[model samples]
Target: MNLYYSFGTVLLLLAITAPTALLFGYGGAMATRSGVAPLRWFGKSYIAIVRGVPDIAFFLFFVIALDQGFEYLRHKIKCPDWNEPIRQGSDFVVCTAAKLPLGNAPQWQHETYGFMLAVLTFAIVFGAFAGNVLFGAMRAVPKAQLETAEAYGMTRRQVTRRVLIPQMWVYALPGLSNLWMVLIKATPLLFLLGVEDIVYWARELGGTKTPNFTAYPHGDWRMWYFLGLLVFYLAFTKLSEVVLSRIMARLTHGQATAGGEAQRKAAA
Candidate 1:
């Protein structure tokens, strides 16, 4: 019961976090498309820097940097009167009260913290790819539609809400669907973040060398575990493609776009 519960928790975390990351990525894309120069620069720089770096490096760098940053702030606040160098021999030592997940916390606490970090890392990395897709899709919105909305006395925000945003999804769906597929594949990286996910537990429980291993131990089984993960991802991608196709059809149903016109002509 305990093992299955833990495994279920991990899957639930990924299911919730992946969509949240996609939302952040979509927001990042919108930010990059802003007319204000500084906002545009900030969003563009975020996407460019994230996409340029290798994901593992980003994971390592961000985790350690964020951990140290949190500790540093705590050190300042909790020990204002007593001063000791924080960096000693390339190790960051802080008061016992300051440790995240703490020295004597339950294993579950540590697991939860690691899962949060993995989600943040996934969001930042995937958001860059999403930004590229969304930026292009936003631009693909027809200018005449915006003008038509204005002719109806709609303001810029109203035009965006009523016309541009709704229409942009059809154009963005192809790219966003591709991004979802990539995100599904990237879930394995949760192992790198120290979450005892399916990958981690599989190797631990499946490997032969450990004396206390369960009855399923076999020699050199890493390949099989990885193969299982690959199939899961492939299945997930196919399911997403089906959902996206349905959404595309619904969104294009009444529009004058090529897809809608095709549907209309077919019906006639």
Candidate 2:
């Protein structure tokens, strides 16, 4: 039962993370393309720094730091009476109320808290990659169309909304499709965040069980479990490729890119 639930956990993480990450990427891309210098620099820096860091290192470090940072803030607010230092010769201390799930939290609460952290971490990491793809897509928009919009007395914002936004997707879809595939592959990293995802279950349930632990003690079956996982991922990505290709065709139907050119030639 737990193993079955782990499959849903993987899908749920993808469903939530994909849109949230896209929102982050969109914001970052827009900032990098903005007229304001600081905003542009911030966007570029976020994309470069996060994307450059190895995923496992980021997962190990960021989750702990973010968890501690939250507890520290809560400790200051909820345990002001304490005079002891938070850092006690290397061991960090915080009030019971400051614990994210509370010390006596139910098992489900702890799992939920861990899952939330995983989602946020995934979003932050993948969003940077998505932003880079989108930034390049934004630049890939032809200068001629933008200049034409300017000459037509269109404001920068208007040109962005009317022409730039709509057209960039044609160029962006291929990169974004690859990013989506990468995101699917990265889902196994949920284990690092302490979330019991499919990979975790495969290893756990497939391991040999002692007679004391269960009546149905069995030999190691990890290979079969992992093979099932391989099939699941391959099928999912194959379907995604088909769907994304269709979307790409739709986006490029009348545009001026190579995909569009091929599409027009096919129609003719």
Candidate 3:
């Protein structure tokens, strides 16, 4: 039950967040290519800043800040009349009632809340990378395609919707697929965000302590536990590659890109 619960939590969190990241990424890409200078700068800066940071640094920084920020807001809303001090030494103390999801909530609620936070963090960090991929893909789209759309009496919006976005995927998939792979690899970071993901449980279950504990208690075995995690990640990446490759083939069909040309030649 624990195994099923943990895996389900991770999968559900990923399903919600991956799409969110993709959508934000697409928006960022479009913004970067906007005709207005300010919009372009805004988009480009977003992509640039995120891409420039180490993923671990961003993860640690954002998670702590966001957690504290949420608690602060709760303190203001829930304890406005009773505050002595929110911070004392290294402790951030909110009134017991203000604890996120609350200490008295069921175990499931705490797990759910932690999972939600992990999803948000993943979406934000990966969205920036996705934005960079998407921006480059948008630019890689042929200028001629846009010009032709304009010549056909299409409005700018029509040109973008009918031509630019559709074709941009063919260019973007390679980069987006790469980003997806990175996102998958980064899932282990969920442990840092306080979710007991597979890696965390694996370590816990595999650890050896004493006969005073149980039959499984023996010696240090962190290496094998981590090796299993490595195997799981490698398998997941290989499966993802297969799926993305098929999508790539579908997207490339009849397009004016090299990938499309390869498909045409193969058909011939």
The models' CA-based lDDT, in order, is 0.78, 0.90, 0.82
- Between prediction 2 and prediction 3, the one with superior lDDT is 2
What is the C-alpha local distance difference test score of candidate 3?
A: 0.82
RMSD of 1: 2.9
lDDT, ranked from best to worst:
2, 3, 1
Task: Encode model 1's per-residue lDDT on 2-40: one tens digit a residue.
Answer: 435545755676687667777877788778877889988
Candidate 1: lDDT over CA atoms?
Answer: 0.78
Error of 1 at 202 (Å): 2.1
The sequence of per-residue lDDT tens digits that candidate 2 reaches over residues 1-268 is 9988898999999999999988899999999998999999999899999977797898888788888988999999999998888899979889888989898989999988888888888888888888998899989899999999999999999999999989888778889899999999999988878888898999999999889999989999999999999999999999999999899778778877787888889889
**Pairs with steric clashes in candidate 3:** none
Error of 2 at 211 (Å): 3.6
Candidate 2 lDDT for residue 184: 94
Top-TM-score structure, candidate number: 2
Error of 3 at 157 (Å): 3.0
